[model samples]
Target: MPVTYIPPEQRKGILESPILQMAMQQRMQQQERQFRERELKLKEQEMPVKNLIQMGNLAKSLSDLGLDPRVILGTKA
Candidate 1:
């Protein structure tokens, strides 16, 4: 492929164009918003698993102390 060299003035004009700047800003904002939404969704999905792990650890600790978790929590086997 032949590389075409653009003049410095044209390059500057293109880079400094307001329309291009606004488009770039909008795209970046949209990408950031999408990233935040995905991050929140992942955290939401992880919450139940985290709660279950915490419950298991608590139960284990209780059993180590000779406490019956099922009875204390009134959960069915």
Candidate 2:
């Protein structure tokens, strides 16, 4: 078996080909987009917990004022 060596110039040419460059750029952009989407999903998941905490605080405040939360929020007791 003989080992074949690709010349440096040819290797550079292959690496710098437009198609390969475009594919690499697209892959990087896709990875970045996926990362951003994952972050957004996590933030969305966290939002409900924060909302619940805020609602609980508001309900406590209403109770301190002798007001029923359900009445204030227009819900059944």
Candidate 3:
């Protein structure tokens, strides 16, 4: 179904209840948050954080050898 466009000037004469507008805005924000959370989850799953321990150990070994441990930056300080 296509929506008929109502000009803003014509739309002004129509009374919109504030509660309905608020509910629509709240629904939009909720959907936006859900979308972002799904994206974050997908990215994290692609490169799981569980590797941190292994990488941190590698960094520590490098540091022990007097090398700069740049991988340490990603680990918990």
Candidate 4:
């Protein structure tokens, strides 16, 4: 494929165009927003798992002390 040579002045103009600049900015903002949303989702998922592990540990400790875990956990007998 033959490379089309754009004159330097035209190339500079294209690069400096306001429309292109705005599009680039919007694209960058979109990417950043997506990244932050994904991070938030991962953190949200992690909290539930962490809470479940902590609850399990607490239940085990309570059972070891001969206490009814279901009662402490608010489950029906």
Candidate 5:
């Protein structure tokens, strides 16, 4: 006896077209707009964080030197 193979038919909802592609593009644009707004807000607050780091380094040097705080920041005459 020989074996016979027959392919099955695809259902109606199995494939997507151009309309679905356009909907995905719109969703991506909305997400990108929200991300850029948040990035701008974060950049505005970064300056204070940089100032704190500079101050921390100065404090460490002052404690290690065993000298007056004014002498560390002053230039040699």
Candidate 6:
């Protein structure tokens, strides 16, 4: 089959057709949703580490004030 050259105006019209435009919008929305999901997963993974660091800081602060961290944090039975 011989490849016929398409005129630029016809190509532009095809690109601007409503069906193609809607498809492009749907593709963009899906990509955005995937990106947000990945971002949420990363933040969820980071939360435990962030909490651990905060706890460590609080323990250190208590120790610096001459308080036993274990006693204040209720580690002893």
Task: Provide the TM-score for each candidate, comma-separated.
Answer: 0.80, 0.72, 0.43, 0.73, 0.44, 0.84
RMSD vs true structure, all candidates: 3.4, 3.6, 8.1, 3.2, 11.4, 2.8
Q: Write the per-residue lDDT of candidate 1 for residues 1-77, one digit (tens) a residue.
A: 99899998789888889999999999999999999999999999999999999999998998999999888777956
Candidates 1 and 4 compared by TM-score, better number: 1
- How do the residues 1-77 of candidate 4 rate in per-residue lDDT, one tens digit apiece? 99898998789888899999999999999999999999999999999999999999999999999998999999846
Extract clashing residue pairs from model 6. none
Ranking by lDDT: 6, 4, 2, 1, 3, 5
- Stretches of candidate 2 off by over 4 Å are 1-9
Error of 2 at 67 (Å): 2.0
Against the true structure, whose TM-score is highest?
Answer: 6
Which candidate, 4 or 5, has the higher lDDT?
Answer: 4
Candidate 1: regions farther than 4 A off:
1-9
- Per residue, candidate 6 scores C-alpha lDDT tens digits across 1-77 of 99999998799888989999999999999999999999999999999999999989999999999999989999867
lDDT of 5 by residue, 1-77 (tens): 99665444542333355676678888899999999999988988997898879866886788678865456766334
Query: Which parts of model 5 are misplaced by more than 4 Å?
Result: 1-15, 67-77
The backbone clash count of each candidate, in order, is 0, 0, 0, 0, 0, 0
Clashing pairs in 5: none
| Maximum-lDDT candidate | 6
Model 5 worst lDDT run, 10 consecutive residues: 6-15
Q: CA lDDT of 72 in candidate 5?
A: 70
Candidate 2: C-alpha RMSD to true structure equals 3.6
